[model samples]
Target: MDYQLIWVLLIAFAVFAYVTLDGFDLGIGILFPFEKKQENRGKMMNAIAPIWDGNETWLVLGGGGLYATFPEAYSLLMTAFYIPVIVMLLALVFRGVAFEFRFKSRDHTNHWDFAFAAGSIIAAAMQGAMLGAFIEGINIKDGHFIGGAFDWISPFSIFCASAVVVGYALLGAGWLIMKVDGPLQGKLRAIAKPAVIWMAANLAVVSLMTTYLNPAYGDRWFSTPNIYYLAPIPIVTVGLMFWLWHAVKRREKTVFGITLSVFFLSYLGFGITLFPHIVPPVISFRDAASPDNSLSFMLVGAVIFLPVILGYTAYAYYVFRGKIDDAGYH
Candidate 1:
């Protein structure tokens, strides 16, 4: 109902969209070398090539929205996580260049593939580390970063990094299952099973760690009214996970869609739990937001531009629909 709350929800939605849409392609890059065959790698690249660049628009919207609507939170976050942010930017550049060049330069395809995979892994790891650090909360004094930059690399951060890798791998496997068929689909199915199991285990560990590290979250999850309402989210998530496992085992075409839904729901839960708190105890949504005039002005542009972006993205995917055949590449 509050304008500040609306901004928070919009930014959260943008972040979740970026993670869900681009996540599979990043996962595909992480799983690239595991395929061990040139043909399979090409197929995997083709599956994501059409929409990967467009998927990153959500990231731009999320980050830009934060800067415009929550300037203080943005400033503090950027200062605290400067090094990791640079690393993520570089990784994104590497991955984007490798994606295009790998197709153009046949002789350097191997080199580009290496770049792509490394970029993807590094980017995913940095993002997970950032998330872990944010959840753990940063050390700020008088609205300034008061800790070392490397403070982000704790055991929990390491666990989060590994979880992201597994998460991406699951998405990659799911994409493969959806886009390719025959032998490749079989191979992807084999890969998806273990990947899902690892993801489930990692999720359990993260959940436990979050609750143990922050007793407040325990209250959020277990105390009275919120628990009853929020209980269904995790329950549905677990059900979806089981359903994804079954679909993968059966080599069902809808496995990718189901796995993505599971991811979306999990993100929804996280977003809900963290609502109205842009930076946990340090900053509430109302305090973090820019002036009301700035927000109102931004809202005007967002109304017209957001729908256009969404429409073009949908059209691009629709135009490129169906499997990536050998002839599709140029």
Candidate 2:
């Protein structure tokens, strides 16, 4: 069996799951400062309180899976992204701290709120910059990352960071639209149109820059037969973006679902672009994968534990499956 390929798919699934699940909550934090009322901020926090910590489960799975299944790729990428990765981790840690302390404090709640929002924004931007740098390709020689510490910082990376910020804000707004009503909901919907516009604009710029910088990616998308097959991706993406805008304007509850689909398509495009390469533009998954024995051992654990994680996640959401009545955590 192609254990290498299987592990790659599994890792990708975990990463994408982390991105979509945690994205909205991080977005909630991103959108936190914009809502002036403490009650509204609590509502935003409450909307995600049940599942926010749990959503990070996928990040552990993805990161751990990569280290276990593709050690070489893990080490190289981690080394290349050490600075940003560390910053992202610290931001997440601070965000979690803020999440816990904000609701507990009465007099100093605003301080905690600032921590949460700042942490979220920093974490999301770092994540996007790391992604952009990865797409920009790593400097690998003799199976080592030969890149500078600040190689991850660039115009493209900064743009990607901005795009992710806006994108997450959109996701947070869509989520809030589903959870709240009255004036706050109206405000969320009000912001959705501009969010969609910015998201679409960002997507176009990223797409153009990605293809222009990488001939292989350009051929993959625009080559004769490939264009016919891949044409629907961008078309459907634009259609969904417009649909989300209209849905929000119409006060349709499908805003969040459509927003998720847009993110999924964007992720799919990314996966397609970097296919067969775990360490992009350099090492293939097969080359980076661990021995078959190790993979088989891990696969057994994955088969047993993966379902447990998914089952609990689904159950949590099911249990908390309605609009939050109060913003109180407990």
Candidate 3:
């Protein structure tokens, strides 16, 4: 009956899907500079080639779902973070182009490679900064964003952006560890070792900073009654961090799964920080949702289409489930 809450969870699911799916491809781009060998780079590209485009389907779903289900929040978010949104979109476009063209040209491969890496970095950074800006809260008055254009740029946003880059790279390294073997996999193990360390450090800093910046968040976690329920999240997170380190060192395939759990926990903490609030600190899901009639209508479509999308996505991964070699996926 709570259409508003349902829609919020749907949107959240879509965003998380996008992060987990598209993350590794963007991460591959982030890790490109570290590996200068074209043969290995080709292998890396080959690893994600089939699924990269499909991974972005969740992004479209999330963005469109927000507009349909939470028009007010979408409007305000677009207006408030227009610059970063545009930059992120453009970067994704450029990255896609690089992905397609890099394989086509022999002589200009390096240029396309650089574009892909740069685009991935820029897109990931903008996404992280936008998240930071959203978390820090937006300036709204009488339901309208009243902040200046550059309000999204700040030390916290920059720090968050840097953290996301490292996080994505970590995801990418774990992915490579799973998809490739031999020296490439070994190199990714090295990359993932340091990447996980930095990611863990960043996660700790960001968690502390988030609480320090918002006293309500501090109370939500550390306050007596709430603390009891929330304590297990951080404890499990620490355990997973150790597991991830061990997995990397042992070249275990579970490395990616462990890394994903860490991201999922971070995402869960973020949701906890802003529960019910789509625009955060100002507007809530109930405040932003469409009319009941509209929600009901869309819900019908979502129900019908959601399974199809999931089915196809699962099939694609299943079909390409084989590992990548110098020759490509097999």
- Model 2, residue 19: distance off in Å is 0.4
- Which predicted model would earn the best lDDT? 3
**Who wins the TM-score comparison?**
3
Candidate 2 vs candidate 3: which has greater TM-score?
A: 3
Tens-place lDDT per residue, model 1, 1-330, is 366777888898899888878888899999887887888888999988888999999999999999999999999889878999999989999999999999899998899999999999999999999888887887888877788979888999889988887898788888777677788889889888888888888877887787776777778888899889988877887887788888898865677787788778767766665665688647777887988888888888988998999899899877877776666633
Clashing pairs in 3: none
The TM-scores, one per candidate, come to 0.96, 0.98, 0.99
Model 2 TM: 0.98
TM-score ranking, best first: 3, 2, 1
Which regions of candidate 2 are displaced past 4 Å?
327-330
**Candidate 1 ranges beyond 4 A from true positions:** none
